[model samples]
Target: MILFENVSKTYPGSHEALSNVSFHLHRGDMAFLTGHSGAGKSTLLKLIALIERTTRGQILIGGQNLAGVTKRKIPYFRRNIGIIFQDHRLLLDRTVFDNVALPLIIAGLDYREITRKVRAALDKVNLLNKEKQLPATLSTGEQQRVGIARAVVNKPPVLLADEPTGNLDPELSEEIMKMFEQFNQVGVTVLIASHDLELIKRMQHRTLVLGKGKLIAQFPEEDS
Candidate 1:
């Protein structure tokens, strides 16, 4: 569902974050993006979400060229993809229900629909019982699950997560990864950017490794 062709991203003073990167993520594919710090993993995700545009080449999602998308249409286009961050990014003042309802609220859905979708998403992350609690009251793993619920509340076809298990213990990390696996089983295209090599290897999914802005290797070469 995602295609990148000869993509590059450069910032001020010729600082190139990515150089000639290319990959294709077929529908229902789940892959891990592995790289060291400053290896451009986050930059690549931003390009897909349109938070940052590519400096060269093209990006296609579901057959639509992102280069042709206008600035005014970015919000609408982004609704097709769900993004999870390492920090969870929940609003401390809001209840779990409200946090997950944010996307639907912004989309102008009515209260009834938002309520239904929010509960369903929280259920997916096993947070339904915590819906009335504030984000600060939940444990780190629960907080991350809240973030996951919020991201998928809209039922976006593609999910992108960056260092999703960065703060959890191995058991919790495995739990979180299993949640992602469940999502993928139902056909949500999942791409996660994480540096947890051992965990990534354990999962045994396709992985793309980067070094100094280049795609240095793809694991289980048979997939290539």
Candidate 2:
């Protein structure tokens, strides 16, 4: 559902985030973008999320060229993708339900449908009981789960997670991974940027490794 062709990113001075990177992700597939610090994983995600435009190359999402997408249309393009972050990025002053319901409200869904989808998403994350709680009131793991709920509440076609498990213990990290796996099973194209080698080794998904802004090796899954 996503393709990057001859992609490169260079900063104002001499910094390069990615260089001539090209890859394709098919719909319903799950993959990991693995690299150490400053490897441009987040840069790649930002490009997809349209937070940053590439200095070079073309990006296509389901055949629409992002290079030509208008600023006014950016929001429409983002509606089909969900993004999760390491920081949880929740608004502490807002209740959990409001935070998760933000997207639906923006999409102009009626209150009844909004209530239904938001609650269902919270239930999937096993946080339905804490719907009324503020983000500060939940534990770190629970707050992260709430972040996941907000991301997926819109039922987006693609999921982008930037170090979603970075702040949690191993057990809680695994729990979050399983939640992502559940969504991937139902056809959310999942791309996670993570450096957790131990957890990644256990998942056994296709991995694309990058370093110093260059393409390294994309290790295909066995039995492929």
lDDT of 1 by residue, 83-200 (tens): 9999999999999999999999999999999999999999999999999999999999999999999989998999999999999999999999999999999999999999999999
Pairs of residues clashing in candidate 1: none
lDDT of 2 by residue, 164-220 (tens): 999999999999999999999999999999999889989988888889887687878
Question: What's each prediction's TM-score?
Answer: 0.97, 0.97
Task: Give the residue spans of candidate 1 off by over 4 A.
Answer: 222-224
Candidate 1, lDDT over the whole model: 0.94
lDDT for model 2 comes to 0.92
Q: Single out the weakest 10-residue window by summed lDDT for candidate 2.
A: 215-224
For model 2 the local lDDT of residue 109 reads 99
